[model samples]
Target: MSDSTKQVTEHEVINYLKEHPEFFINNPGLLQQLTIGNPQGDVVSLADRKMLQLQTKNQQLAKQMKQLIANAQRSEGLMDRLFQLLTDLSMNAPKGEFVSALVGFIQKDFASDYFKLYLGDIKLSDDEVCVHYHSAQLKTLFASFNNNDAPLAGRLPAVKLKALFGDESAAQSAIVLPIGAKAAHGLLAFGSKDDQKFHPDHASDVLQKLAQILAVFFDSQAVNDGQQSQS
Candidate 1:
């Protein structure tokens, strides 16, 4: 036969084997004789290669399952802590006491190096926990915060870090969350001494929820203050 005819016949044999998968089961000796070439220029029995592939896949699946379980446990713990914080805030602490309690919980429970709440034009007697800034100042400082409600986490610029924290601040990383939907109120900033503590890829769902809860507290305080002034 011609070389072309031999090539066509070889291809037809492969196609036929694929179509009749049971053919190998009937001919056990043929399977034992089949060898496949490996990337390392070694030859292994086809059956052995297939078994190795299955073992690798099973190992990968086990690793993935373990990671998923660990993530779920961490998430449950965080949820429990968040619920406790909400309960504590609901006890109707006075304005100064509330600010103190909030800052203490954030610093101790959340392990934040520095935490500050900035309120635009909203006056607070506890200047240590809260800061008052003009609308123009906020716009100028946080120009990159396009989505006001979204949390921003990463290494902050030196100028921005100095503006938020004082000139003496030694924070390496930070997370900033807008307090209100319209961002008319202000922002909540959390700083960390560890540079890798906060990154752009970090998940912010929990932080955003916490910011929303704080917004409710601020709004309630504003309403109460308005009522007291009218009385």
Candidate 2:
């Protein structure tokens, strides 16, 4: 027989197998010897190749599910901590002590390297709360917060951080949250030495809630002080 004739015969056999899907079922032993190259260019039996694909897919799915569970657990833990903080703040501690407690909780639980509370116009005797009267410096330093009432997370220019925190500030990443709007505007800044600790894409829901709770606390204190002064 000619080589061309042999090639045509081989092609005919392949075509016949392609047309008959049940050929493998009738000859199950042939599947053991049939080999295919995987993504790594390693030859493996047909069944082994299929099994490897399934294993890889399962590993990927497992990893994703594990990450989701870890995230959920972290969220739950944060909520619990927030509830505890709220409860602690509700005890009507002294003004200075209250500020201390707030900062203490953030530093101990939230793992923040630096925490500063900036009240735009509200006066607080507590050194923890830095009262900044509205000025061009304030506006320029927090340009990213202009007219925006949301939380911001990311790096800040060295000059801006120095202006807000201090010349000795060592934070590489930060979260800035606007407390009250309009006349009672204030800000809460949390910072960390780790650059990636706070990013624009980080979840802000919990941080926003924390800021709102603090705003209410500050506003309540202001009202109480006003009533006392009037009396």
Which is the leading candidate under lDDT? 1
lDDT of each: 0.74, 0.73
For candidate 1, which ten residues in a row score worst on lDDT?
A: 126-135
Top candidate by TM-score? 2
Candidate 1 residue 98 C-alpha distance from true site, Å: 2.0
lDDT of 1 by residue, 59-166 (tens): 999998997787678667877887886776663556556656666656655667877777664446644544445356665778656555567789989877767777
Question: Which residue pairs come into collision in candidate 1?
Answer: none
lDDT of 2 by residue, 1-231 (tens): 887676557789889989998999999999999998856788989999889889999999999899879777877888898788777666355655665676666666665777777655444664544445445676666666666777778887777667667788788888888776631456777788888988988767766776777677778777888999999
Instruction: Enumerate clash totals for all models, in the order shown.
Output: 0, 0
